[model samples]
Target chain A: MKRNDFDFSQPNKQSYAAIVFLAYHFFRILVRQLWPVLIAVLVGRENLKNMLFWIIAGISVLVFVFAVISYLRYYFYIDNDELVVVKGIFKRSRTNIPFQRIQTINIEQSILHQLLQVAKLEVDTAGSKGTEFSFSALSMAKAEALRQVVLEQKSKILPLPQTSGVEKISGSELALQTILHLSFSELIRIGATQNHLRSLLIILAFFMTLYNQVEDIGVDTDQVVDQINEEVVYFGKIAIIILGLMSVLASFTFSLIRTIIRYYDFTLFRTNDGFKIVSGLFTKKQISAKDHKIQYISWADNPLKRLLGLYDVYLKQASSSEVRDTKSISIPGCNSKNVERIKFYYVSPEEWKDLKNFKISGKYIYVRVLYFGILPAIILGSLMLFTDFKIYSLLTALWPLLVYLAFRVNHKKWNFAINHELIYIRNGIFGNYFKALRLYKIQSMALRQSIYQRKHQLATITIYTASGNINIPYVHLDLAKDICNFVLFKIESDKRKWM
Target chain B: MEFLNEQIDVKGLPDITDIQAEKLAANYLKVIFITRGLTSFIFITGIVVAAILLKDISVTIRFSVAGLLIILFIWFFSLSSKVFNTRSYAIRQRDIIYTRGLLFKSTTIVPFNRIQHAEIVSGPIDRFYNLSSLKIFTAGGSQSDLSLPGLLSSDAARIKSFIISKTAQDEEE
Candidate 1:
């Protein structure tokens, strides 16, 4: 540490050590990726070329050394009013953030950082992407001490009570809440149904690619296909086994890497402002919002997870006018009991009581399942019938179609919602999500009557919240308008500050 | 900031007087009904789109869509004229009120301190008729954020200046 430059506000040694460790591992991974090219060049039977590869490797090593030096040299200081960071090579850049604008401070440590006994500090402000400032790798104790100091300084400038007059609970209570809500089974189910369908399809495509690669390298593609078609694959059993194993391993590796990167040691901590979420391994992320920033809260419980009483909750926060796209932050694997507790943080008990519980009308479920299944089947069947195909073509298509229809039916059966304290929606087949959002956060309301709906005297009332839009379909048109008017009246009449 | 303590205590918000409510609710129904014309124009465009998309449908379907479109157009025109002539305002000890709706009546009450910004806007239609709309913004995230619409330009200007002065005076305390 630079003793003279270092003041009481500077980070401790553990933080620097952690950053150095991170840089070391990252550099090592980079070198490993480039190793094969260097080995190929070295073994090309040209002495001069081999020497060039060695020189390049030497340069890479030098770069690694420089990266470490930079990480170690970087330092920051916190004054009463602002946080100043002095960092760079060749030219030092000093960045200052005012204390009053400080939104929240997050402390995060991944498994690697945990092993190193270091934690990272991130300071987030409104409208800033990621944290405005991050203090890399410090001892957890020192990180907490520094965090406390910063918080104290910030409070002096803002002078607002940390939690806006909410009850504060012990860490043990938080830990219990975390454990009760965090369901591993739900996470796995979520992993399965998630956008991973795209990945699963991609993985299947990758397998075909690998299969073609093997064929191009010498294996006979025609013989392999013929064997599978004829059910006579004795000649290439060993090769088939090897290929199957390779594909499985590759897919598993892809899934594992994706899951690790997206949700490595994800944690949520209750804070005075709201909940703080910390996740990520390589490029860590932290998000903090006050209760008022949240526009809607929703949750999902999948079929298998529902059996195990597992679900996930998400808070959709308002989009800043400066940025059009907004995202929802989720606390995955939450149990049913935690949903109410989480809602309690944002709404009063009386307001919570006003939320209406809505279940998918049986007629709607029938409509959804029929539309999802029969419509596609009819369209595909007609098109296929018009084209050249055998009698069994429809039957062959029936397999995936039937499976999808079953899933759709199951999904629609489970979707429901209510408007009481907040509007709560429960959706999904295997995993159930119960989400409740306060009405006051809605930016606009529209009662839309489609020609089909109008004939039925029904309309879809869409509540456009700051974050996103939610539509309650097939309600009586007059009732929808009445509800819309009621909501608009209440929203305009309220004097509460949302942000 | 201390000026807010003197203008009107915000703690008095919950109980609004009937006179204040009536004052704010004035011309609300007329303006709301008139705005239906604007909404009908928008809705008719959807009917035209449907007619084009579902061309292979029966004559009855086509006739129905066309009829709905024509009816909505007429409704829009009928309401448009009435909206301009309507106006209303209400006042409570803690807040001011405004209400506007046609068939479905809606009312809005804004506390004195809750006003973040206010604007008086006029378009070609309003300019021709000597009418303006007052849009008041608060910090909250509600879509019903706008308080009143369809006022005489002069009335809107007076309200804006009054609110501004009131805000300034409240801050002085």
Candidate 2:
């Protein structure tokens, strides 16, 4: 730890403690895939209890033996400029990851790992040929030593890297500056600010999917529903209200627990040339998003978060979408000041003023409102007029009204700003989302228009970055073209590397 | 760092609004129509046969279905012509632009430096006509990639080499 550097040129197997992790992983996968079968055998009509017990014991022992063998087989070493991993028993295979392509080295610590004072190190590379292997168990000092070697600025890799993912989390000492830290109160506030409505919607969707699956499996869902309905009617509206309240309460509690587990004692630090975020409770994770690799920075607040004076900030790094999903980092509960600091570190947010501003046409909502709102409303109205379902009229009136309100909110929140260096998009409804990107970072530009938009002289432009994309919908056709051309010019003229 | 945020004069910049984009080979239109026409004819003919043979479907409905089959062919040919005209490509000094589509029209631009790779491809019919397409890949992944079909094989090869050279120059820089 004091040296901050060590050698791993000699091949060595993982720590003996790795067997515990390997066995845990093997058993977890077994239970995850066979839980239903396990339950069926246990509760089934057949009395083959002795056979089942023997089978379980046999599998467990076999799993332990396999884990031990795997642990013994796994060997890693640094050979030249590549990190080499040689593993597998019968079907031998080896992987070589160059230090240049190794984009990020992250650390994770489960409860067991923490108790054993060991950590899991996951190595993520840039492309589809990703080296997404991990050491299931390694001493913290050894993992740190490996990271130190790989992340060295002057290490032998082709065309020296501009920004390295030099990082610090809880243990290994490295040069890092504390940017922000969340107190216990802030964590609670963050949990409180989570959108319970969204969580509830997801839960409802999950249950609907589950019900459909059960119905497909020959269950009499309608009969079950009728019985539930009868019970509900017998209990009356008060009981229904209580049930709704309980579900809402359950969703809120679920959101809070998830927030705490994922972001307990969150800390953001500024490394020499990048941003490092360390978080989690039982499975501690630490990742660094290098300055040059970060393609876009976004921050937003929901209605609740806005009330609490906090914003959730996300740094999208350069990669394909699949890799980006694992690479990107989101920091919740950053106040306006913290967000500004983060934004400043990436791009000068203050320089956004005096830049050209563009608005998505008011007609943007017309297609949505007409198709999604009014058309359905009109269809339902006619249906109600033709049929005896009088309650449908109320529904017909209710839908368009909600859509129109949403339209009003969305219209207020849609627009973008751009200058020679940066593109800032402001969007969202009832809250605010700001996505800031550098013009030169865009990998491609797409200008789109539907027939209706062409008739109205409107167009949309999508600027694709390595991480994701920013779409400005229904701007003036000419404006979209101009923005596209300007971005292309910037990309061509600029010599700076996007990654 | 000097004047990095200078106000961009968009008017002075190169505009792709009315460039003389190179149209796809004319005979390739035959390729497009031939393939689509064959598929449409087979399906429509099958439906026509079904319409004529089915006794339970009724006369008015059968005749209307028969009428729609002809109209569908007419509509398909007309739409295909319009779409064929919309497809064109232009190469700038540092980037390539592809203009395509009729209903949901789109124009995509990919800078050479940003392009990960480019390749020339030809289907069997395309090979018969000595026509190939150039696909430009970027780090932005598949959706943002551009594919320009209906080019002469020589032209496709030329464009692929040009793109490769440009990207290689960036690496050298």
Candidate 3:
């Protein structure tokens, strides 16, 4: 079908794929809520277990029927430039969203949705509560048309700057450029750099569930462990070394497989409207961000990635909530040049080198040392006298480590710089995280001081933007005041839309 | 939209420290004391009832709980006044500045152009004292949002309208 083939003027139901998805959704929730009862009935006598199977089958059929009914009742349409969704079996409550209020439109296609030739559509609105509405299934072409229409209607209503000689770029001015793309080799490098501990945790959790299932089927896992222990005793430390090597190998493999699959051929495109990211192998997720919607840009690097001069860039798009909006988009495996280009897209194109760097006061380490080092060490030292802690030796060794970490984090890792147009923050221990934002985009500024800091004439300045907050802590009180005043002046002097 | 970035000396800019801020109403203190007094009374009553109902518990624990509650009440009552006295807000020519907290002092500034909306809020207790609060929201989240409490209803209404007047002018264009 053509892009505009669907009848948007008339109310339409979601694609037929919704029936299966809605049923699966409801079934999962039902099983999650009633798993204890199901487990109890299964552990009972054979006759009751047999009856429980049939009862579950009946419930599945009932749930499927209810999903179909719910799908039939739901209706969505656009009228008077407002998107309206009416859905309820008995209550029949209706929601009306003005075009101007709609923030972002997201489309996602999982493997199942791909098989069904449909996609999930999400609409996030801007407000205090940030109400979100999602449709389980819609034809790809129709979803695109819907998003385009909503964006067009929204752009028309929202006022744009018409004061300067610069003509506003419309859809007609579309010029798509490949801002950044990851090749197979780069993807491999990125996959290799993926947090292996997280992958290992996932593998362990999977095995744990499998082991629980085997135990439920009456397997003697304790006997298996005892056998392993016997083998370990025979091999001595060699067995432990081998086991450690095997776990590391398995974790690396798992991380590589997951990262490759998730970001097989990720491409970031710079469109006239904004930036569009298309990636994923089995599940295709597309994120588009308009220039106006982006609040700030941040890039971070780990020690491993830092070795390869690699950074993962994130566009912190304006969103009331991250869970529902999917507004923030992260692109991994970007080189320094790629990061610079992306940063220039959101922030000013001036050189950030000449800006004077302001480090957080050395007094900042006092609280960190007091709370983390002295307090914990004192507590553990006092407790060591009355209690035997051979089993808690690991806990005993933690205080010194905490103290060192506090010193490393606050002493050398903090730097804040600001020019007339934008602000930059660089912080982190071992690896660095950098954030840059336009000054006019700032919403509010606050300077805070604790009793200790108040006595020391130090304050923390927090700048709130549409996306999130950025804090520069333990600066001189006069510097904080000057920063707040200057930032407020920037925001007040400019007449531009933050998002 | 206009290119208005011009270099200026930072020293010449208007300072926020010079502006005078208005203190909270006296009735606000009474409101806090009454609410805290009621809570303290309930706790004391519960302790007395539990002490009588469970005679196995020693007098030390019973009296300790009561004493702790009383001490906490006194501490909070004193802190409330200190916090109230410390709290003040100033409506500047281009922004609003509010300073709060007793121990951890904080000052917030919100430019008029950045404000999303202004709300007047009053609960049952606030109305009993003929007082209300004005909440100012920006594109920023709750952390940066401003709420000025312990104001006469008429005063709150006036400030809200003043903010709305400044913010609405930008919207109209």
Top of the candidates by DockQ: 2
Cα-based lDDT for every prediction: 0.59, 0.83, 0.81
**Candidate 2 segments exceeding 4 Å error:** A1-7, A32-49, A153-175, A205-226, A321-327, A349-353, A379-391, B1-8, B42-74
Residues A1-499 of candidate 3: C-alpha lDDT, one tens digit per residue: 1236876778989888899998998899888778767776677576986787798898889889879988999889888789989887678978988988887788999999999999999997877463678988998878878888877766677654332223556433267799887888999999888778888899899999989977876779999989999999999999999999999999999988888888977999887557888888888887788777778888999889988999998888877733245346889999999998888666546435446579999887777778877778778777776778645745656777777775767478889888887789998866789998878889899889999999999999989988888988899988888878778877887667676
lDDT of 2 by residue, B25-67 (tens): 9978988888878878887788888888998989999889788
Model 3, position A490: C-alpha lDDT score: 74
What digit string (tens of lDDT, one per residue) describes model 1 on residues B15-110? 332353333224434545546756776778877777778869987879786887778687667765444333356655444666444443334455
**lDDT tens per residue, model 3, B91-123:** 997899999998789989999888988898997
Report model 1's TM-score to 2 decimal places: 0.58
Consecutive 10-residue window with the lowest summed lDDT within model 2 chain A: A163-172
What DockQ does model 2 achieve?
Answer: 0.59
Model 1 alpha-carbon miss at residue A157, Å: 3.3
